[model samples]
Target: MNPRATPTAPPAPGPDSLTERYVHAVTRRLPEDQRDDVARELRATVADRADSLHDAGATDDEAERAAVTELGDPDRLAADYRGSAQQLIGPALYPAWARMLRILLLVVVPIVVVVVTVVDLLDGADAGSLIGGAVTTALGVGVQLAFWVTLVYALLDRTLSRAEAEQACGGPWSPDDLPPVRTSRGSVGDLAASLAFYALVAGALVWQQLRPPVDGHPLIDPALWSFWIPVLLVALAGEAAYEVWKWRTGWTRRTALLNLVPTTLFALPLAYLAWSERLLDPDAVAAIQQGWPDFDPGVAHLVVLAVCVVVWVWDVVDGFRRAA
Candidate 1:
């Protein structure tokens, strides 16, 4: 009789099986230099685990599924093997990243869209062009904001130590940092009003130049159109952007300090112009004098300067009060 042939171990699962697919998923994410070794090791480990399960009375298909399931998500496993983080911004920096992104989207994006729309409207663009310009501006600004914000946070996540990252994200949270709860509807209305006021201010600045002149002179000094008027408009735009940020973030000492920048930009220039008697066009002033003989230019200048001082002080005070 022929010698009895010893039964050899069963061959490992085929390439198309669940175990092979799982191995592929994991190795694909790994570096090319590490892929071959990792794939071989992973495949052998999975096959052995599956075989043991099968011996324990699981069917071949059930064993293969169980082996892969026990390994968890392939993306996570790949990250483990590479010794890298699984997130763009880790938990330490995520809150700051999220808050910054919200502020940018809520503030910068709308400002960009509105500016583009207004420019297009002033150019007498057709309705289609106006809508398209606004939409495109919004999308472009949003994409830029997201990419840059993510890249910055990702770099910080990789390069900074944990303590450094926490500090960079404004340090550990405290009860004092918590914002006072306010009605959401009221906040929304306030934001809307602030935005609208800025829009009107911007529109008025441009409209003054476009409107028919009174007595051969614009209401504002024509010389101002060369520099100071544009500066004022830019300052107003900055204020508008800050207003949106403040609305979202609520008040803080830092924000209050920042508020002084745009306020000074606007008020200082006006005050200087008023004090030097260069604010109104001489022709416009003459026309006004003709209508009201008792109008005093000196009194008007003083009144304008006083109003600027009062408004600037009130705004600065209000910001700190809200923060407190």
Candidate 2:
């Protein structure tokens, strides 16, 4: 039997009134297990307040409205109930800390991984060794990033006055400053997945160089390593940073336009390389010819070009669509 499906007594009915609406707003933000109890307690408190006001000669409607107003914004009240008001970083610095940590993790971690992987690749390490080294380095870097960022924020929280902290965090928060309900545009999971995908791509680019050589040449042309490959790697890093910024700021028309820079930087050069038949080693091409004898490199180039164009267009379009 499903635990969630287990039978339980229904909640006692409350009046369909202003207090009910206020209670619902507060309790809805609470954990499911706590909601019923919190809702009941909140309703009782509101009733008592309203009763006192009514006894002081206010009408029922006025008393109820005043009681609810006295409780303040339901969202803020919910935060208090959840004990979010207390923290190592405190409320003022917590938001800034979280945002900075997210940016650092998203932007810095992947770059560190890619750089470590590339360095290991250049050092002539085997694929397994390089991959393991990259993973270990990434973990170390991540821990350091988290530790330092937290320490700095904790120091700031301790050192700054409340007014200073509030100013640094973009002033004291208000009901008007409450964020809208979240949408799917800037999901952390999605950003992580994208970074992981780029890391895999970087790994693949490095691994291809270590493949069994055809006439002492890897599958990818070594000549392009001087410029094209390095530029591509830099572009990939830029793309990763862009993903982090997008996740931090969410989609917007300006960001959508900015997205084109890294997308084109990656796609156009790759397409050009593939189209000009410089992407793959000539010996590798010859080996393919020897095996199949009918392999047309032009067809391969066109396929690559088409794929690049399609992916580039789709990414740009999706950004604008999400922003909208």
Candidate 3:
């Protein structure tokens, strides 16, 4: 008489079981909306396959192993169901990456151009050299931004492979995740006014040089124009940068500290010109004196210099007070 074969033990139950783990592997990568339905279908399919194998004379353990093996790697199965194969930066993250790149290019390129141009000009560079330096700086910054941003996203895509669809987005992102209402240190009107002021000052300075000379003397000393104009542009650029920073980051102790550099850079030159009695074109001053015989030019110059200094001090104090 042939003895009956000993019954083999079925797979373990609970989280440690092969079936639950495999199901979890697949479902974790799926969206919550699809997870329940897909899990049910997957479990049903696996059970049906196992039962068929059991009827074909395979034991429970053997059937379970065969069924899981037939489905192949858990990761591959998840990818297949999601229809997203491995990618450097998947479709899920491509839009974010593109948006970031656009913002960086728009913001960084202009800042870099301003900085490079200022540096070159301060070094007594020719116009050609200043333009070339700006271009080079912008190109370098662009390449660095592209490379690092892409590399980071690629790493995130690969590392977040096992995360749930929503979880892989870095967090549970929802409409509620957005700020309730936007707030800033400065308003749009303030930024616009500041920008307009810079434009007007720059235009006025340039016009003085371009306009016909008054009695063989320009509104500004041409020699001072060659040197001081660049200095003024640099100061203007620094102030513009601070305005942008304030608009974006709002007031902060850090911003207040940063304000010191630009104010000092701006005031020092104007203060020097005022003290040395060379800020205005002598001919222009003489013409003014001719019109007002009682006017004391030295006193007027001292008053203007004092006003500039006071303005700078007031600006620095205001920045810190706002931060507080």
Task: Give the number of the best model, judged by TM-score.
Answer: 1
Which runs in model 2 stand beyond 4 Å of their true positions? Answer: 1-121, 124-185, 213-217
By lDDT, highest first, what's the ranking?
1, 2, 3
Candidate 3 per-residue C-alpha lDDT over 55-151 given as tens digits, one digit per residue, 9 for 90 to 100: 7899877887799889989888888888875667877777667867765675666666785665565567998888788888889999999999889
Instruction: List per-prediction Cα lDDT, in the order shown.
Output: 0.81, 0.81, 0.74
Per-candidate clashes, comma-separated: 0, 0, 0
Q: What is the TM-score of each candidate against the true structure?
A: 0.67, 0.48, 0.48
Best-fitting candidate, scored by lDDT: 1
TM-score of 3: 0.48
Tens digit of per-residue lDDT, candidate 1, span 1-324: 744332332567787988789999999989999999999999877877777787778987888799899999998999999999878888988899998898678767865676566667767899999998888888999999999999999999999989999889778777877654543322878888987997798887778767836766677787887678767776777788888777766787877887898788889998988888888777788888898988887788889899988999999999888767
Judge candidate 2 against the unseen true structure and give its global Cα lDDT, from 0 to 1.
0.81
Worst 10 residues of 2 by lDDT: 2-11
TM-score of 1: 0.67
Model 3, position 229: C-alpha lDDT score: 67
Q: For residues 187-238, write the lDDT of model 2, one tens digit per residue.
A: 7888999999887886677777866556556778888877788778867887
